[model samples]
Target: MSTTERPRILVVGGGYVGLYAAKRIMKKMRYGEATVTVVDPRSYMTYQPFLPEVAAGSISPRHVVVPLRRVLPKAEVLTGRVTTIDQDRKVAVVTPLVGEAYELPFDYLVIALGAVSRTFPIPGLAEQGIGMKGVEEGIGLRNHVLEQLDKAESTTDENVRRKALTFVFVGGGFAGAETIGEVEDMARDAAKYYSTIKREDMRFILVDAADKILPEVGPKLGTWGKEHLESRGIEIYLNTSMDSCVDGHVVLKNGLEVDSNTIVWTAGVKPNPALARYGLPLGPRGHVDTAPTLQVQGTDYIWAAGDNAQVPDVASRKAGVENAWCPPNAQHALRQAKVLGDNVVSGMRGFPQKEYEHSNKGAVAGLGLHKGVAMIVMGKMKIKLKGRLAWYMHRGYHGMAMPTWNRKIRVFADWTLGMFLKREVVALGALETPREEFYEAAKPAPAPAAAAAPAQKAKAS
Candidate 1:
């Protein structure tokens, strides 16, 4: 190439947006024309749709994640977090996983930092709740739920058994609903193998503050979803919010009380708070404010997309709505990524930039092994489906959208293998504390009982 003329496009966050954006930019750019550097705390991008499957042992955790380094070989993938940015200086402060932090300069910056789990200030939630944001959380949840089963089966205390068998999930969005469904299926099947526990003994409760659940698919399908879950023996608590879960003593706003050992929080997500440090114009909800073109409002040098950006929904605007913004979901994130990447390339080459405009295609969610809900939007046709057909559609859609063919094949293979082999229900809880035995071994032995104090006893005699 040249001595130092290639433009550096710095992409923050190696997630759905950052990964796909960088990949697209690489394809659109000529060799040695520009360099794309992607930075994130994690080195891999997780496909969130499959998290429920991972928790339910329907798929291996490794198959759902794509290593950033492997997928974007042409791009410089840095495993770190962009802590701060000085827009005037065109430099960003990046903190690595270990060691010191440093500044990185760039010609064009893309903020794809993504979102984090939205949690409330509920009492004891910080100490006692489990979340499903990443593969680690999925694996942890699986191990944790199964471990609770072990505790309940082995324990004699009635209260302890009751607590261990009870599982309370908050929120009824895609995450909460799918998670509880999958986990319940796995837990129920697991109970079959336990001599002491029956599926009837386990309590699975789903709570939502709203009157309805799965609002993304309209009311008809949502009503069906609620009924389906309730039919499976799951307690559906509508318009009820958790007041407190202090020491596993759950108190609900509906005047219900329960002492449960498991509390899963999957309320929703908010944009990453790091946008404030970048000196960018943000929306009322703290998302980076952008034009329909995906460019930062009044900035030609910087762009933003994904969950962290409030990109105007041109499709909604075309239909005579002004205040509408794209919903923060994988569907928008994936498409916005391509447009953002293309815009970055076009902006660099003095070509015209394209405005991001796409309507919601639909939404699909797998409730469990053989159950699901899907909404397909085609012009005026709003096709809503439920049960086994929707379940297959859920798998088909996400399996194809899983980043790479290699991963798609692996995921399909996991499913095919699962068809013949039983789900691996063993809880390797020890994986959480792999070094526990080593730590115990390394502990110093007691100080020989203070040499028996033999001399003192003999002198007294």
Candidate 2:
């Protein structure tokens, strides 16, 4: 902790990029020459690709996140949020979880604070919409979906039961499609446990402004995905948007309206606006403008990557086609973190830096159990897969891509056990506030009506 000893590298956000970047820097650095300190609000980095599976009960929630402390054993992990950074002074103001705000001095800074869910000024969205950004949100969604079934089964009123069974998802991208598919699958399986609620009683609707869903998998596969979901009784509303979801009543732009208790918002994500306060160069999309080398523009001491940074693609080149800007996904983030980490070390050692370049390996998506689509681009040929084969491929690819061996094995185990056992339909909706029920039960009962009436009558008499 001494000011004069070793140069300190302060990394903000412990997400995909931040976690890997810190690990690389710590591992690459010579013994005792520099210090790597990572500050994040969360102590673990969530592998977001598997979040849909977690929500669907295909994988345990704990296995999808990698603990920052355990992964980066050599580096200093501070659980906190960076409020602001005085770039000129090379100091960041961080507010720790349990203590007062303090200043953290750094020789170099890495701004890897990722994106947040993009939201508009829509009526009632703030209160009714559920986001799928973190592990907690994933679990909340799972519980919420199951709780709806519980509500439908217990309610005698048809209106209330219908409202409980009507689930709406606003978005067509990976998160939205995957989440809705997984949740629908879970709900379908769960119907067997209930006496009144049946799979036919539920209504699953997906709304997106785009023309098609799963655009990452190319137009053909995207069309196929739409057909697959539609065949499964999911209402896919394309070329449309949500007008309003206020008070649990959804009004669509295409002159459609429905009342539902669950609304999941996964339209898109924007870069965290916290970077604007740091006075760094930003692109049109509000992402930090960084060179191909992953160094923050106009600064050698600051670096950035992941969804927060606008780094050049360096792979796409076709005259009229837009090139030199990579899309923000786990594929690019993992590779970018490695180069960024090495570049930071190279800069510290006064060595040459390397530019990042990687072609898209194609895309894969799982609709539900034993149903998926994959398109792998290998040289000139593109391989398209679907059904159970694609589902296995989707799970296989992600199972291996998961962070550590411990997590990978656990995730595989979840899938293996799932083959023989029925999916868990029990909803722990009270997970967020289990104590509320305890408080309600412990409260004293109201005095009997007869005792109060008799006392009042005697006094009057």
Q: Name the candidate that leads on TM-score.
A: 1
Model 2 residue runs over 4 Å out of place are 1-4, 318-320, 441-461
Give the Å shift of residue 360 in candidate 1.
Answer: 1.3
lDDT of model 1 at residue 156? 99
Give me the overall lDDT of model 2: 0.90
Residues 207-277, model 2: lDDT tens digits: 99999999988888888888988888999999999888889999999999999999999999999988898
lDDT of 1 by residue, 139-249 (tens): 999999999999999999999999999999999989999999999999998998899999999999999999888888788999999999999999999999999999999
Candidate 2, 171: how far from true, in Å? 0.6
Worst 10 residues of 2 by lDDT: 315-324
Clashing pairs in 2: 313-324, 313-325
